[model samples]
Target: MNKKLRKWFRGLTAGKAVHFLLALLWFGLTLFPLYFTVVSSLKLDNEIWDTMFQLPSIPQWENYFKAAETAGILSAIVNSVVISLGSVAIMIVCVMMSSYVIARRLIKRAKALNLYLLAALMIPLQGAIVPIVQMVGAVGGKNNFFVLMLIYVGLNISISSFILVGYIGGISREIDEAAAIDGCNLFQTIFRIIFPISMPGVATAAIVGFLNVYNELPIANVILTKTENRTISVALLAFQGDYQTSLSLIFASIVIVIIPILIFYLLCQEKVEHGLASGAIKG
Candidate 1:
């Protein structure tokens, strides 16, 4: 038995070592481009090509600053931040309130409401974009922030509310009864009790919505006509159109466009992971 155990332990150690090496190689493959981008962003054009494989003598922090100027990077960043946050904020409000009402409110049409949201999940964004744009334009939403916010919120509602509602459903009914006994009305209970309890769902909605809103280009490119108002994703197009091209500057700006999203993911990855895990367990 001792000899058998020793053999098994040796085999497990060898397997683990092979697995570790494979994982490290894969990780390096994924990370090298990101490392290259960061390094490329910091180097002079000459340094980039001449010493392409070499690290910078001293880091060039000015690439982001220069790119920021040439690409109107600051203004584009502001527009992105505002739109991303605004969209997420609006999504959270509608999704939470709607999900809470459908879950906790004593409405007779609960089944119908659930069915409606599920149906919404099946509807393609591409199918709705034409009518949605026309409707918004008709409503004087051309170049309007409020209208854009409404559009983002509405488009996101199906997924966000579906997740929220599912989690709300999983929550203990006794919790609701206890809150009611403590003099909480539906509104009070939802805001004070349910939202806090279902925080994982809220975080899930936020991270997903933030990512989508940050990178979305089609609608922003089509409707956000004002150059000053264009989001980073759209603004990146201006660096090189067909008529004129600057490959280096364009890649430099592409590097700039990636930073904020990278920062957001790095900062919120822990929360996002936690939210997903907690929600999965609750669900």
Candidate 2:
């Protein structure tokens, strides 16, 4: 074992050894928090701090049930899914059409309009909270999922357009000409030709928009006042009290809340990676 270890160590150059050790360090740093959360979730409330780094004597599987029931996690999950998915769907459609128009300069002053939309990226949501609340109240839309979804779509358009416009612009205009030559209308060309070719960008925008709406708390807290309309982020906030907090239950809820994001990422992982790679290279 010693001879093999020495041989292996000798085979690695100094830079490779340094990089390997640094990679291992980064891996451990990234993995430890998740390990801690899982371990803590399986422990008793008292056992959590007492044996912070140790395994629980017996797992507390009941914590998940208790957290889910007490926090209304299941319903919150539904609300989040509805709002996030709805918002992403609307944002994608709007941004895609707008981005295509901007990319192709189809509309007058398209560059000016693109710049105007991209300018929203610099405005923080908090800064506009008062105006948003006033606008929503003026329209008599409160505690409404549709309203919230629309707000999400509006907020996300800037970045989504920025990502997609650049991506769509990278595609050859000759394809559009070809589609035109084949007797396809403008909308038909966009749907059939540009849509498939720009899927990576769309995937990227969808993922970003979904994540933004799903995890957003400030706007949701302000607008989704009803218990039934509470999102997962708001539901998690309910776990905290003035005098008492359950760490184990919070950890369990954390685990539950992350499952959907994991599933979504797994589904869109390929497209997102390709989109990012294409953007980096093209940009």
Candidate 3:
């Protein structure tokens, strides 16, 4: 029995060691592109192709400034920030209120309404792009940032609501009753009591919404035709030409765009992880 137990323990240890090595390998693979982008961005365009891994003998810091100027990156960054933040803020408020009402069964047709909202998630945005574009044109909403914000909010509402619903369902009704007893109205109770408690769900929804709006290219490209109104994703196209492209400048632009997102993620990493985990378990 002792000999058999020793052999089993050895096998388990070996298995864990193999898994550890695989995880490291996967991590390296995942990080290689980002590492390459940083290194390549600093090298001259001519040297990029030749020296894939070598450090640049002379770092071209001006590549970033040149890329920014050529692409109107500052304006693009502003547009992206405004649109993403506005959409996320609006989405969170609307979704939280809708989810709260639905989860609490506050209305006569709550079940039906919940089902209808969830159904929206199944519909692909690509299928409705034509109609959306036509509607935007009819209202002169093309190239308008506010219109873009509305579009993003509408697109994200259903999924955000669904996630919030699952999380809201886990909250006890006693909290609502207690808040009411303290002379709080429905809106006040929800905002003061429930909203604070549901930060995990809110954070989860916000992160998802922000990413969706920030990285979305198809809709932004169609809606924002004007150069000044373009987001970073759309503005990146300015670096490409029909015959020749500035490879270093393009890489530098990529790095600049990536920095804000990376910083945001790092700052909110703990909250994001916690929010996702809590939402998954409770939702």
lDDT of 3 by residue, 1-283 (tens): 9999889777777779799899999999999999999999999999998999998999999999999999988889889999999999988888888889998999989989889988998998898799889999999999998999999999998878777888888899999999999999989988899999989888888988998899888889999999889999999999889999999999999999989989998998887787777666775
What are the lDDT scores of the predictions, listed in order? 0.79, 0.90, 0.90
TM-score of each: 0.80, 0.91, 0.89
Candidate 1, TM-score vs. the true structure?
A: 0.80
Deviation of model 3 at 133, angstroms: 1.0
Candidate 3 lDDT (Cα, 0 to 1): 0.90
lDDT (Cα, tens digit) per residue for candidate 2, span 102-173? 999999999999899889899989898999899999998889889889999999999888888889889999
lDDT by residue for model 1 over 118-182, one digit each (tens)?
Answer: 79879977888899888978887777777777788777787777678767877888998999999
Residue 141 of candidate 2: its Cα lDDT? 84
Candidate 2 weakest lDDT stretch, 10 residues: 274-283
Candidate 1 vs candidate 3: the TM-score winner is: 3
- Kindly indicate the candidate among 2 and 3 with the higher TM-score: 2
Model 3 quality (TM-score):
0.89
Candidate 3 residue spans exceeding 4 A from truth: 1-12, 108-124
Q: Which stretches of candidate 2 lie over 4 Å from their true place?
A: 1-11
Tell me how far the alpha carbon of residue 56 in candidate 1 is from the true structure, in angstroms, after superposition. Answer: 6.3
Native-to-model Cα distance after best TM-score fit, residue 123 in candidate 1, in Å: 4.5
